[model samples]
Target: MPGERTKYAWRREILATRAQVSPAEHAVEAAALAASNTRLTGVDDVVCAYVPVRGEPGDLRMLDALREHGATVLLPVTGEPGPLSWARYEGPDSLRKARYGLLEPTTETLGPATVAEAATILVPALAVDRRGVRLGRGAGYYDRTLGAARADVRLIAVVRDNELVDRLPEEPHDRRMGWALTPDGGLRQLGRDLPVSPE
Candidate 1:
């Protein structure tokens, strides 16, 4: 029997099979790499980062580095089906538990209009291909959000090294990444900027 698989199944299988590493170590390396790359570019001012939930790629280290570099941070707040609201990330203290295991900011909530002002956005992905196409959590939150942002905004996907692969099933609306930050290899351009084949 050819059984059908749900989107949740794809997300679970990939996440379960991903390399298991100490969160602290991965956070340290990813933070240093991201910080270095952000400094070199000189364009990243306001960054969008996620609050670690369900053991995603980055921990608080990435947020800390961005703040230390004088970049304002924003986090996603669950909104309607196709849009997301962002709130200025003041600190860990400003977070409150939300649905889907996501910790969101409780300070000042902002509308989607503010996303355009961000110079860079660090997106969370389940898997990303060499073409920079990202497979997210399947809610289509980022796809809709990124679609509305300015074309020049740097959309970087943060993932474990192995998760950044050569190829993945892509949809037309899937947003591409300009860079990928991994613990092992530091920061590397994923698709548009580099000619490397997808792993």
Candidate 2:
């Protein structure tokens, strides 16, 4: 298993070398593209976050698409060591700068119970392998937050096409993704099997 220190180093190296587009532009375009995809269905209530793209993760285009489709959107707020607090997202105007330069909703604060109602969750990941293992920024936030979700809830990871690789180092706490969304490739299911670690 990969150690936490190695995971952090790998994430830093990947972020340092990855090509990124403008957050604002990517957000708008990605949202439009995702909205056009037919696979993203039954998403009534969604739990997502506006992360800093390029330097952070993919744009919040997915969130915008969800909002445009009349689905209720929620943003995660940092809570105790392992959990996340959620707030109802109204729009761009309803957000304010929060920890880690993340733009989060400032409206009514909701707990894990409220987030559990979301039919789909858009998670931010550093990289996702074809086998569905997601490598995040070494943060266990999504892994913890997703514990509240129903077993059947769709967990999609938003990433660049190149970020979806054939393999990546994984650890026990690392959660798997059901689907991956990219600008070029709309939405593709990562399938259900976890990849075997390289010996």
Candidate 3:
């Protein structure tokens, strides 16, 4: 089992640093992040992403870019404390404020298994190690959610350039990411080459 003490400390350190980023700099990074991701080639599969809140990098523009790339984008409809349900993202105008300050689509709930249908899953991370270990908020929502995804699904963590660290403490329940998409680097595959490719 994973200890909450280390997780809480990492979250605090990462979030405090992110909070100091000026709005102007954050805007520039967000733009670059969107542009970099949208330019990725051969991404036509359904993309599962989140509507980043607070100091998390990227915005709904990233989701829109996925949609424009001929993908069916699914955003999370957080309910309770277990696996998350999904809903198709129509556009910016359809989002409504929900609990925890999240903006979710007004579309019908598509159940948590919807994560299994995505070829790509973009997660919000405070930091991710080169070994693909991801450091997320202490909530554990993503950990439970990712447990239901297909084995071959491409798990990508969204973070700032500095958040891609050399290592992070890992636990048994901690699901590893296959890539880290940063504001500066766009998309960089993590872990060793496994002869497999992602959409």
Candidate 4:
């Protein structure tokens, strides 16, 4: 199994792979992902989600689909490299270009603790292992934010089907995903019971 040093290598490899995905493939995957949202959370649930940037797994329509399903959606507001603040996602028209080229909601800013209001949180990951270890883009945003969420909240990492691997380097501060949502695979429950240490 790969260790901490290999994590950066994994990030580079995964990102390069994602960058090669054609627009046609991305559209198909985005449509499929939007269709699978209902299986991940129920109506009336507060969902903490993010807008896909840099060829990530989802599109804005995924957020709209959640709203159409009767759930209130919240988008992250990037601040000074800490727990993310959120704002209600009204629609595509409600978003404004923010830091790091991210689109954020134009509504009032909700505090970091607001993540606890979500019943499900759609996390962005470069890849996730069967054991629920998530590899992020080296930024500690989700790491800091997830610590403030409700313990029972569904932490689902959204990735491509191929991004779901057998194992990933794990750190003590890393928050494990309870589930993974892939375009082709839909929603899959991860094996949290699996041992964290590498064999």
Candidate 5:
């Protein structure tokens, strides 16, 4: 684990680096990620995923893949700084720019607890460590909402290949992920099975 100041610095550096990626690189990686097969699909379960904005890896392709394969995908509906609400994702046509640089659905909002139905959740991360420590954009939205998800829900972080590091600054409240999704690697288990205590 790392102190708050260290985590903040890491966030700054990682984001700066991500911002430097060229548009050509972004398109290529995004395409590869979308085309990569994750054995996670075809479960016929509710899966929670986020729409990537900025230079984040994977586009709406991940959600589309899930929906086309088997899962009934749910996307985040942003609100105040606590547990996030959700909505069924129809497609990119349904997303409207929301607060905090997020592209959210215009569909009916569902409560945070609706995440309990998810069998897997694809989280956006700047980086993730082998220990399953995830570094988000510092808003803490996922941290709050994750507690509402079923304990067994496969929490997976989505990032570029190099973004997977050996370790990261982690706090007690920072939720852990069970796996990572990369553009080339597809799905790689973080191998951290730590019990998620109620936040």
Candidate 6:
């Protein structure tokens, strides 16, 4: 198990840095992030993504781009703190306020197992290291949920360019991201790839 204290420290520092990004800068980054994400999916592909809240990278446009590119987008239907259930994302209007200030799809839930349908998963992360260790918010929702997906699924961590860091503490339960999607870096493979760059 990784030290919770170290994870908490990393979360605090990254969030503090995210909080400093101005709205204008964030919007520009979001657009670029959305553009890059479009390359990952195509018609009929099942994609699991999330609504970016707080200072997380990208925005509704990212989801929209995926949908417009003909992918079936699924957003998390957050309930208690276990594995997250998923629902088909119709559009911005399809979302309703949910627990933790998240916007979830009003469409019928496809259940937690629906994650298995996705070819790619755009995960929300505070930071990700070259070794594919992802630093997420303290909640373990993703760690629990991702374990159910197919081993070959492309687990992509969505973060700002600078949020891609040198290293992070990892717990045995922590799910490793296979790729990192950044505003500038686009899609970069992790782990064996020593120098991260767009794929």
| Least accurate 10 contiguous residues by lDDT in model 1 | 35-44
Give per-residue CA lDDT, model 1, range 1-199, as digits (tens).
Answer: 2465444676787778654666676667556655554452343477877876676766676776778777888899887786778998887788899988889988889998778878788889887777888878888888888876777887777777777877677677777888776666556677654532221
lDDT (Cα, tens digit) per residue for candidate 3, span 1-199: 3554476788899999999999899888888777866654345688888898998998777878877877888899988899999999999987999999999999898999989998789998999988899998878899999989999888988899999988788999999999888876777888862322333
Root-mean-square deviation of Cα positions for candidate 2 versus the true structure, in angstroms: 5.7
lDDT of 5 by residue, 1-199 (tens): 3344477887888889889999999988888777753356555878888888888997888778778777788999888889989999998898999888889988999999999989888898999989899999888999998988887888989899889988888789999898888887777878653322221
Ranking by TM-score: 6, 4, 3, 5, 1, 2
Q: State which candidate, 3 or 5, has the greater lDDT.
A: 3
Error of 4 at 110 (Å): 0.4
What's the true lDDT of residue 99 in model 5?
Answer: 89
Where does the lowest 10-residue lDDT sum fall in candidate 6?
190-199
The CA lDDT at 61 in model 5 is 82
Off by over 4 Å in 5: 1-5, 192-199
lDDT per residue for candidate 4 within 1-199, as digits (tens), equals 4245488989999999999999999999999999888656788999999999999988998998999989999999999989999999999999999989899999999999999999999999999999899999999999999999998999989999999999888889999999888898888889943322111
- Per-residue lDDT tens digits for candidate 6, residues 105-185, read 999987899899999999999999988999988888999899899888999999888888888888898889999998987
Off by over 4 Å in 3: 1-5, 40-44, 193-199
Lowest lDDT sum, 10 consecutive residues, model 2, at: 190-199
Candidate 4: RMSD over Cα atoms? 4.7
Over the full model, what C-alpha lDDT does candidate 1 score relative to the true structure? 0.73
Off by over 4 Å in 4: 1-5, 192-199
Error of 5 at 33 (Å): 1.6
Candidate 2: residue pairs that collide: none
lDDT of each: 0.73, 0.68, 0.85, 0.90, 0.83, 0.90
Write one digit per residue (lDDT tens) for candidate 2, span 1-199: 5343465676876686564556585566565455543346544646454444445444455566667776777788876667688887787788888776678788978776765777777788877888888888756788887887888887877777677887777778777888876666667778743322111
Report lDDT (Cα) of residue 192, candidate 4.
48
